[model samples]
Target: MTYSRSQDSPDRRAEFPQTDLRGSIDGLLNAFYQGTSKEAARYDLTTHEFNLLSACLKRKEECTATELARVLPVDASRISRIVTILVDRGLLKRRRLPSDRRVVMLSLSEEGVELTTRILRRINRNSARLMEGIDEDEIHIFTSVVSRIVTNHDAIQNSE
Candidate 1:
């Protein structure tokens, strides 16, 4: 007897048309996060840790844990975890303010500052590689479109 393959065998290709928009968004977000995490890991840091460092770098002065939680897009617990790890690594110094014992201010230690600067240079190099084929005008337009998408989402949420 001869055996034959079924004509209704499952398709091997991606069913993009059948996939939900939310699923696509989730996939892209996960891939982006994973890539960034790998990049951070190369420099002995996690994405969250790098984000905290970046937030501190952007701030005009020392920032408190609450302030960091507010400024960064992540939740408070995640901020706390990253802060704890940075402190353990001796890359971040946390001090309780004399005026307010409840508030813990965070600042980069000398090592943390050095590490952040080095990581930033590496990130810039990687970004340059990614933007190699893209022109300045196209980059600006892309950024504008992204900004509009964010604004549109914000408006939708506010209108609800």
Candidate 2:
């Protein structure tokens, strides 16, 4: 689960749907995520692990476990488990943050970076294929609709 910073934008949030937005959204995601997972398998990476590694690569330094949990939309305990696996696989290094000893920081290993880069490239190519025949305007409209839902969901979460 890569953390999308765009999720914080009011224009990109979403509310609970009175219609079947959930189904539509899930279907869209499942198709893409499933394909991405198959591509990741060649590198022995789980879908979630690949996503987390990619997110870590976007940063200049290690991220604390709490940050991963919050940003990835996973519960803290689950994030902890995932981090442990990543570390055991030599894909990540876990250490105490210099500023806060209580926080565990995560950073990728050299091999981890290479592996993730490959996976990202493959996934990007696969996604491009899916959008190949679609017009740019259509893609823009689709993305815009999804952005609105994200904004509504953010509003719902904030109110709660």
Candidate 3:
């Protein structure tokens, strides 16, 4: 699908021609979330908790709540609540940074790492199954297009 500016207001309005793209994207997202939710439930986690753990695993270093909030779609308060639950459950560690006593740093606990790894493995397997019939070239093109879409989305958001 292509992006176009609406003649109604070139500066304020954009349009994407009605196509299967929206439906297809929605279907893919729904399927992915359904699979993730099921896998997360196996570990007694909500999808939000699972997402927080996954983000922490990717950081590979202690990070602040602000950093996580930047990456996550949730608000700061929601992030705080999730962090509290994870910390209390022993899946995450929270410590005040020495250089900045007021700032709390977050990291995955050993248990969190293990659980994230297992969940990632399951998710990867599911992804492989989902892409079983697709060729590498097709996958590459799909990823490139998706990246462009994300860039466009960010541009629009920032512009506003």
Candidate 4:
């Protein structure tokens, strides 16, 4: 009288893979995204602001607005606006390059460094929690699939 979930209705697998890999990945991302912005809000930063800072932190040396824009893969104007706001907030510092005054360089402000460090730590903790139940092998496979999908998307974008 009682049927297991899979035994009840498993025929969809014939048409759609049981894993529904892309959908599964998208669902996981959507679910995680719901809570992630809330986490950034705790520090008064929108998720996008946090991401912009995170990109700046990737380089050891001061990076130009153009550089951040390229790595962020956003329009130069967008990065310029974001950088200007962060600078006014004292979360970032911008200066003219000593050797080339026309070129501007940017680095995290002392406070920016502190804030980004805390934000990255929190994100890493969340990431670890998400992976908690999965074994190492499962994680490797999951990462591989995600990587391949990302590469494919990038290739498709480049083609356009």
Give the true-structure RMSD of model 4. Answer: 5.1
Q: Over 4 Å off in model 2, which ranges?
A: 1-23
lDDT of 4 by residue, 1-160 (tens): 4323355346765566645554566678776775567677898887767777888787867989888877775789878888888898899899997799999989998899889888788777887888788999998987898798789988998999
Q: How far in Å is the alpha carbon of 21 misplaced in model 4?
A: 2.9
Number of the candidate with higher lDDT, 3 or 4: 3
TM of each candidate vs. truth: 0.74, 0.80, 0.88, 0.79
Note the residue pairs that clash in candidate 3: none
For candidate 3, the lDDT comes to 0.89
TM-score winner, 2 or 4 = 2
Local distance difference test values of all predictions, in order: 0.77, 0.80, 0.89, 0.79
Ranking 2 against 4 by lDDT, winner: 2
Deviation in Å, model 4, residue 151 alpha carbon? 2.3
Top candidate, metric TM-score: 3
- TM-score-sorted candidate list, best first: 3, 2, 4, 1
Sorted on lDDT, highest at the top, how do the candidates line up?
3, 2, 4, 1
- Over 1-160, each residue of candidate 3 has an lDDT whose tens digit, in order, gives 4333333353343354333576578778888999999999999999999999999999999998889999998999999999999999999999997888999999999999999999999988897888889999999999999999999999999999
Candidate 3 lDDT at 81 equals: 97
